[model samples]
Target: MDFIDEHLNHIKDKGLYRDFKFFTSSQSKYTSIDNRRVLLMASNNYLDLCADDRLKEAAEKAIYTYGVGSGGSRLITGSCKLHDQLEKKIADFKGAEAAIIFNTGYMANIGTITAISDQEWIIFSDELNHASIIDGCRLSGAKVVIYKHCNLDHLQEKIKIHQGKKRLIVTDGVFSMDGDIAPLDKIVELAKENKILTMVDDAHGTGVLGDNGAGSVEHFNLKGDIDIQVGTFSKALASEGGFVVGSKSLIEYLRHKARSFIYSTALSPVTIAVSLRSLDIVKNEREPRVKLLENSKWFQAKLRKLGFNVLESKTAIIALIIGNAAKARKLSEKLFEEGIFITAIRPPTVPDNTSRLRITLMSTHNRKDLKFALERLKKAGMELDVI
Candidate 1:
């Protein structure tokens, strides 16, 4: 097949092409697109800290001091005092012995999984695990076993089958599409009994769960038992980066052997500085997270009262199951037209028949916005016949 023809044929056959909008304003309740301002319900800025002025000032200060960009990879020239401090700060925040930063969540997961796993190790992952984790498992060359989503018994069965090999149980703290949390305590106990290592990608959990926003590990009070806590700054931290926290030796090993970290440029100084400041904000300004949780609870309650099938979650993610790709997309576009912009997730991002509207909440959204969102969603639901 000719190159352009082949690509065009693929797009036409699968309906996979997508176009993105450019936002001209801060990622808050309202975003500008096509010269129209609409309420945004699609961003992962859970805490609404992404465009915080203090953090931006910190980033600007960092740029003045360190200049823009890390000129080389961390192993060669990008490693800086700021990076070391950020790592230490993250370790302390997450109650880990040490931490190491990565350029992105995908790199962090892939690099760690590939670097530490071996043939003798079996990577037991949940069926609904993120694509990054799936790719990581493939890179590890370890035997990958898929367990049922949040089904402890099924996971135990897989563990039984792979018992002979070293076990590495991996799961996402918050299932992105389903808006459900993992059975962490159950998984932790099972792994301990089986002497298996455990890894959790808390990309959505951090800065949204637990008292101090320490995430799932602290939410379950399973300190030191769970082996690794992988997180990203792009979500709650309002910056662009990722990191993995573990024991001192484990992080040191990653520093030496995680090819993604060793070869890829480190997170820029501005990002590190901004994340560090955001951490402080999460630690001290407790009211925002408190409001965030309150908003989530109220929104869920309102959705149920309005006869919408809002998926249950202890975090900021709310998934309204629409079940058909075309219908989901239509509903999302309708919501946007109604001035409540939500993202419609369809097949491949989810299973074939489980398309949904992924509505995320932020502390900045008050009762008025929530009420308006609920109204618009109800209207969309009626239009799509999803309710």
Candidate 2:
């Protein structure tokens, strides 16, 4: 009669149990997966900066200087010299008047949205916004209206309908599931006419979009117009932690009023150092983004040529849509056996009948590796009767 056991039983029946894969080596183009050397296409190490020597050295130097771990919460004792320096550098990189760091991208979204808005604010969110944004809306107790994903017409209609209320418009800079981008330029114009505050969670967009990976805000040239820009260091940055970039007043308000930032232990000195180095690496080495785009375009075009249902992607995320969850899982397993690695995304992560084999590319993968993956994909598609 317990609800927990009932859900567990249902999950077991559906073959939907989830667990982590313990990697015995650093993340890279290839990994020691399930006792076999497999080509890794599932990682978020987009620009292949995770294994870069600069970041490694930065962390090592910090550990030598500041020791391991921040011992207390930021407000009481954990804000180290490195954390302050990192924040300043991030602000400069993001073109924000100021920036504040947080423990994770999830907490940054959760804490900031909750801190800045309240029940009286009407939060208009994209239908496909990430879970963190959804949870943030709930925590804020805001009257949330969901607009169809990336449909500016629907968004505009909702804006006009809800004209009298204090409004906040939020969206994912790059929607994680489908690999498509938000119409930020039009969204900003709509926000301006309606007098709304705008926030974008650029977790996957930071090191993938714009002329040189400056993110969605920069891609749309809305640097100062965006009320908040939340980003993660875990993806293209190849590090950990999150930051909110905005005006000095907003940054200061979150620094003091955001409970998650106030109560949580600060990012360790080594993490701060690694992220700082990543910022340098991402900006100074522009070749990775170029190579990344080439790799993604190659795979996407080939997948379509082979008749697989590859979703449209402008960034590093690519998805092969397979309608049935069981079939999607089978496709992933078959691909793994063929020495390719990918993740199978299913319901709740996406809607029903929209299961997909999510493939992410890195700049480290070469042309031969690219051709090898395409061959394996063709074989897998043929075996699954998908082609």
Query: CA RMSD for every model?
Result: 1.6, 1.2
Mind giving the per-residue lDDT tens digits that candidate 1 earns over 1-387?
499889877754554445687787877778787778998888889888877899989999999999978888888888778999999999998999999999998899999999899777799999999898999999888889999999999998888877774679999998888778899999999998999999999988888888888887888887797898898888977887889999999999998989888888777888889989999898777787889888988999999898887889878889888777777888888988898888888778888878888989898999999999988888888877888
lDDT of 2 by residue, 1-387 (tens): 799999988876675656666677778898877578899999989987787888899999999999988999988789899889889988888899999999999999999999988988899999999999999999999889999999999998898888655789999999998888899999989888888999999999898877768787888888888989999998999999989999999999998888889999888899999998999888787788888988888889989998999889988899899988888888898998998889899888888888998899998899999899999988998999978
Misplaced by over 4 Å in model 1 are: 1-16
Off by over 4 Å in 2: none
lDDT of 1: 0.87
Predicted structure 1, TM vs. truth: 0.96
TM-score of each: 0.96, 0.97
Candidate lDDT (C-alpha), each: 0.87, 0.89
Model 2 TM-score relative to the real fold: 0.97
